[model samples]
Target: MSELRKKWITAPLLKLIKKVLPPISETEREAMEAGEVWWDAQLLSGKPDWDQLLSMGPPQLSEEEQAFLDGPVEELCRMVDDWKISFEDRDISPEIWEFLKKERFFGIIIPKEYGGLGFSPTAHGEIVTKVSTRSTCVGVTVMVPNSLGPGELLMAHGTDEQKQYYLPRLADGREIPCFGLTSPEAGSDAAAMVDRGVVCYGDYKGEKTLGMRVDWHKRYITLGPVATVLGLAFKLYDPDHLLGDKEALGITVALVPTDTEGVTIGQRHLPAMQAFQNGPNWGVDVFIPMEWIIGGRENVGRGWYMLMSALAAGRGISLPSLSTGGAKMAARTTGAYARIREQFGIPIGKFEGVQRRLAEIASVAYVLDSAHKTTTRALDAGHKPAVVTAIMKAHATHGLRQAINDAMDIHAGKGIMDGPLNYLGNVYRAVPVAITVEGANILTRSLMIFGQGAIRCHPYLFEEMLAAENPDTKEGVEALDKLLPKHMLFQVKTFIRGVFHGWTGGLFANSPRGVGYAAKYYRQMDRYSAVLTLVTEISLLSLGGGLKRKEQISGRLGDVLSQLYLLSCTLKRFKDDGSPREDRPLLEFAMRAGLHNIEVSLMEVFQNFPRRFLGQLMHFLAMPWGHSIRTASDRQSHACAELLMEPSETRDRLTRGVFLGNPGDGVDLVEQAFNKVCATESLRDKLKKGGIRAFNREAIDAGLERELISGEEAAELREAAEAVNMAIQVDHFDHLGTRES
Candidate 1:
């Protein structure tokens, strides 16, 4: 591989991340000052609550907690699972939506006063998980209105009258609200939206331009076909030179009854979120009173800000909860099926390869769950975490995609087919869209997180800085960019300093696992924080002339930014939880897997750009995976070994992954274990139908208990894995503080 290519594939910078992680306090405010990771508010200071496990106490299974957790998640699982039923029957039952709404699913996000559940983010997540487990379509419909629709807007900015008039009806489904934002020319670029309005001033001066004459077309509107009221976003222009009314402002949100005069919502257009009611709603020259503005007349021309604040919380809730639940459901179903489905006289679950993935799927499920909860709590705390939400959306979705995929791998031929056996396939098809929506993961990371952070999270002079950059003075505009770098660099240096002060501050950081998770935390923050800054500057410059171009840049930024946010959240949880593995099992697992994934996806995205820029694509494609990235290879291998211990015939199913997997690891271990088990036909045949329990029973019969791992074996495993990992690190040139190759 080329030197740059090596850097892209390996993870050398992991060292730096490890160094910086311990100092991160319970508050992420420190990251803002040191990382220049700011926006919207003053940067916070202090350390993270790294000793979370201690604070949380042990992972004891309370009877109530266990019961709640173990309850028929099947009801929830069927939501996404039935897609297989649909493809097999080529249709779905109406019971899907009915089953959800009747369960009070529709009311989860609405406040209790509004005749709804008035649930918190976690509650909403649980409901979505249930919906997505059986059907992502159901998840989509259930999530849209309650989480991101009119209810969110009204709560945030609506006038008392508006909330009182609309929220209750919406909660009961007596009136369904649809948000009209994206237009034909705008997909990810909402600010460049083409819809606009001219104020309708009366000939009388007292009522100058209190209403607007609007024209616009919007597509990809969920519930558009069935909406009773439309929350429309359009630019407000001073038509007839009317300036007194709020309608004279530039951009505004208006709630229009679909039946109002001069208003018409068009036909339903096919959209990829095709499972439920989805369509495009268009309008031209629609007349709407200025009172229709969300949050009332006081906040006109501020639609973007209003919408964005609500979306941050909504995004965190939707994809993370839905995706995590879906993945867990898929894994649960697939694992059970693999255990029961026999081949070569043994069940598939006995295979080491399958075991490895199961472990990973389980690990991911928990991590995603924890991370989802963290973000939800943040929302409940009223954090309004813009950057954090993006991260949750991207990271959770990415992990879910993998968890579902791992299930498919174990399912093999059964998974590949479009039948009840291949239940995981339908949700898998939607992987890309999940990542692309809500500003796309790219923009969430690369632009919005850091760009917004630089302005929002700075210490001391954040407000002055924002004012400096956005000053009305021409000189201020010209000099602000230059002033920004000095302050930004100072923050970056603080981050470096804080990293060194870690663990020295406490016993937790010194613990091996705490160290690992902390390392991952800082490494990720450092790796992307700078690149995000660069992308932000460039995007801002690009937008000076071509305002819309920033949207595309924003999308790219979102992807990188989203990854960073999720990774940080994962690290925070891992460190705080105090897992006991040598490398801090949970922490290490999250890191190795997260790093490997982020790197690969980053590479794919980076390489997707013009190939001609390979030599010096500094401003273009950035490196993804590098040697600094950590590896959970040791754990993965151990788990895989357990999975491969099935019968010989079941071993055949693993043939595909072995060829596709890394060449260095002893790929034959799984197959070899299978053959050894299958040598005795009688034993293999007996275990085929229920190999997992049977094999596990046999292990008990064999008396292989209390394996603390001999020092010799531990040394050998470490030697082998460490060597392999070292090679990867060197090959990827990860030592350099670079994000993209």
Candidate 2:
């Protein structure tokens, strides 16, 4: 056996493998090594253990966290005016800022031992969602400190003294913080940064001190204008070899006080007119003590890993929460408008075209909420999940953008006009901001999602790369001999499973015993998983190093993986929310859409593949019986739309956590009209039965006199009709843009 392995596997296999191995750059290698994998790795394994997914605890807030959201978060929302903040003020009020600091809103993730709220990851996401629903500007302000800013970095890698001193200050808002990582030349590529810091000796308060002379120019910083401290990233160099014999150090992080000499701040940039305190800042020959390094002097040249680790919080929690909030708000308000506003003597929502858009909005809301909840729950379970975080950031923002566009189409003139009553206009404007931040959607979808994930989540690819790169040829060959056989077996098994599942329509795929409504979805996802695994291996073998440059193929693969994850989240949400019969329409819509996307994305990849035979082979294995899944049916869409157009527990749960102010407000008016319309459904049917189609006040009075309806019922119907009319009216502003001055 050993002799057969030596000739057939060891020498020949190693030579071929080395020739096919892709070259990984320094930055790419660092990124692949940054965060640990979790459930994403399970899906890549082609046989996810359903028991593990079921074992994860559902996300829940503690009493203290719940109270904080109920009390202070609610108060903050009431204090905010989105129209005023976006247009007139361009920033939150002084009182709101003071309230946030006092309530520890900026320190939701900080531990209580410091001066913060110590909320769990789920609570933190909840706070962001609720606040963002009320005011995007204030939400950005609050989320920055709690997310990728100094507080998070400090908690992850700061020295003990740095934590003790800085955490309390950051928690109490004595020192507002911002992080600077994106230089002009390095928006998506941090390794291309030109910002620099040179190690040198400098005079401190009294004596000579060791520090770096740093110079940096960074833009798009969220809280740059008002930050008291800056978390800066710059390439480091030691020309004199001050700390080490090596001249160049990699990226390094430092904590520089904004008040220090040669530090710049106090300007703002209006991002998509959603105006938070975002701006650019500059540092010219700034001197800092060595202790100011985030993890101290010994931790120099490790800035990229630190930033990558800290990014999981913002990417996975804050932005996704904000997107979810916007989607839910759109679903609620658009549904209300569609029900009350009539055209051609009937509610527009009854029209098929309008129903399609409304259904899309509701399904997007449902899916975004589910993904947000599931990802945050994973974070609370102590998993960083870098690839999952990237997926969440890209897909949630994209979903929000889609939902907002559909909502605008449904709202028509009401959506076009901008005023205090325009609840959706600001969110629509903020869509680009969400898509552009954390990571640009284009770069993330094309490169980061699949490029990083393919190696990080794959079972044997990373090991093979390490083995191929080993310096000793004999050692590398031996390692590949062992790995090659196992890898080939895995590929063959996945291919067979893919072909069998595709032919049988996933009838034989595994499902959890008590999944109930979710059983079919589980089996479908398993079939897709096997297909994805088989295609991934074939593509790697066919494309090798060129796969990195084939971003279009990578992006399509990302879509399939993203849809699988979203579908999984939808199933999890159904079970966790008690699997209500009323919510089945939403579940069906989300699942069907996800499966269709997976099929379409795979087809697109196959069509564009470089290797013709492999592409055709993948197609046959993925869909042996031709296209089996189609988009959601119109019946399913109308059902989802009906849930939104009327008052039901399902609608209430889907739209929960958004701010609904007093009765006169836009959202409140819609809510009131929805309730009134639902209450009078049977009354309208009674009038129709009495042959009184158009029930004007006179007709209602006539019906009352004829005893077709009672006096109280006539009055109730008249009141309901009036409420619907009032709810359909949009606020009109004068040429000066003032509502009623």
Candidate 3:
């Protein structure tokens, strides 16, 4: 333990702070007792360990996996159109549901031995991204089963018998599974849940057996309406001590059959206009045998750990995929729409204002896609990056929010209009649902990412804290003695690196051999990393235990950490994807943007420090280096916009899986129209010079009649007009008729 840890353990200041600060809640207490350190916790120690990350490489997809994505997954996404089902039927059509079940869409993550397709995390992400681009409702339907639900929980913690019974049923979709974790009162603070299960002898199927009588009220459960089995998390109580002496066994997870007596399921919630089976469920006096307990009775009271672990594996995959999908869709569609839609006789994309937004949209899409791919690779490598997942979920959704807003700004009225022809509206409406789920962006940022991460990721911090709280004085001292020397050395190294990098602009930091401008980005990241380490140490030492209560400061620190991780991913992506020259501007923009955000976060940390003198001192230490960081230039923005304006192999690669068009919908009509208009540029210029600008169908016919232009010019002009008309079209639906009268 460093001096900070020593002080945290034995200092009078901590003791004083503990008294004045709010007491730790049950949730916090439970988390401490669980005592598992995650990957993010290690990174928070301020050391950049690139060996594992760099060595992992990009996620690989086998030929069969690729074929599955291109075949059944692609076909399934096309079949469930959000526009048709959202307002009219309010759920996926029966045919689509049956197809998903038969194709085992719900079992992508289960093991092959368990009768499901055992796919890599990368493949799972690809499937969700492709599906999300077409319909969020379908995406949620697919994601819930594969993510933090019973299937995952069972695989990780189920008894052999439980696995033998449940996994196959779940894998085959013979049992539709939904996990009830979030309650009406307990959202983020799940330890505060009121639902309870009591151990006692209860009549089950007319036989007296030792079981738990559970009563639970859960809301916002995905697939609740149609689920046949629900994985329920509740507080388990044993007042009679039927099996153990403990009265309470913390939080416990159990598999509850939805059709059992006293179980009520299927009260639906219409989230925005997008429809999926999301609803509330409750059970009164529901009896389940001890075997139903996940991981058997041995794992009782460990539900929080199980849920967190399950989330660690799957959380980083799903929502980030959805967000990246939205970004790709927005970039692809808005780029084409801006070119095809004309205002003042030129494409709206030509305007500088629109170009700025387009640049942001493209940049966001690129960065988010890069982050998603890189993080998923980490997951596939067997690292459960809990903090990374939290950061990705919060940050990617935020990026998606910005990308969608920019897309809407560029599309103007067309984006706001709700219809099948309007591609951007449904995604925009579903923004809240994405940001609010998994973990709300606010809590994830302010608490989970940095709050838990700072203690968890720091090399000696968790050990030191655990030792301090340990009852045996000799053991605590021995542990601290073991860690203290290394911790002190780490602090010394951090100090030297900070001063050296800060003074010389990272000139001494090792840069990869033969890399070009990206080398400077790597160096800049080094400088920021040094600064981040120094500040994190200073903040923890200065704030002590009270830092947990200071959410604003914690959130800013998280921002700094998250930006660094994202920048790292961006650089890795540039290298992993063959370092294409066309993507240089995007890479530049992403780096500058990340550095600017880090600088801002640093300033915020300094500004919000509880100790004014310490804040000023730290700001002085950060000095000219911190203040000198700049954002991407307008020229870079223009270059990014230009990349989006014209269709190229690069643009196509970036937006490859985005759903542009399918049969029965004119989705690609805009791209087709833009291509046609651009193809006849010579004729268009001649007509414009001849004072025949803004030609509609009638105007083109009139021009032909008067011989203002040749027959060929008129014919091409008519084609452009018709294509534009179809491209700008929006659907009209009868809202009242589609609803209950």
Give the top-scoring candidate (TM-score): 2
Best by lDDT: 2
Sort order, lDDT high to low: 2, 3, 1
Please identify model 2 stretches exceeding 4 Å from their true place: 1-12, 471-475, 689-710
lDDT of 2: 0.86
Cα RMSD of predicted structure 2:
2.0
Task: Find the 10 residues in a row with the least total lDDT in model 1.
Answer: 654-663
Best of the two (1, 2) by lDDT: 2
Candidate 1's residue-wise lDDT over 498-575, tens digit each?
A: 333321221222222335436635544444444443333433333332322344433454555554555555554554
lDDT of 3 by residue, 506-616 (tens): 777755554565888878777777878888887877787778889999999999889888888888788887788999988978888888888888888888799988887
lDDT of 2 by residue, 1-741 (tens): 986886776777666666786877677777778778887887777887877776775799999999998999999998888888888888888998899889988889989998888888899999999988877788888888888889999999999999999999999899999999988878847779999999999988978999999998999998999899999999999999999899988989999999999998847888998879999999999998899999899889998888888885568998899999999999998898898777764689999999999999999999999989999998998889899999999999999999999999998888888877778888899999999999999999999888778889888888888777862477777777778789889888888887888888899999877778778889999988888887888888889878888999999998888888878888888888888889999998888888988888999898899988888888887786767777779999999999999888999999889888655766777778777877887887778788776645876787788788888999898987788766666777677777863
TM-score of each: 0.66, 0.96, 0.94
Q: Which ten residues in a row have the lowest lDDT in candidate 2?
A: 470-479
- Candidate 3 — which pairs collide? 1-483, 1-484, 41-456, 41-457, 42-457
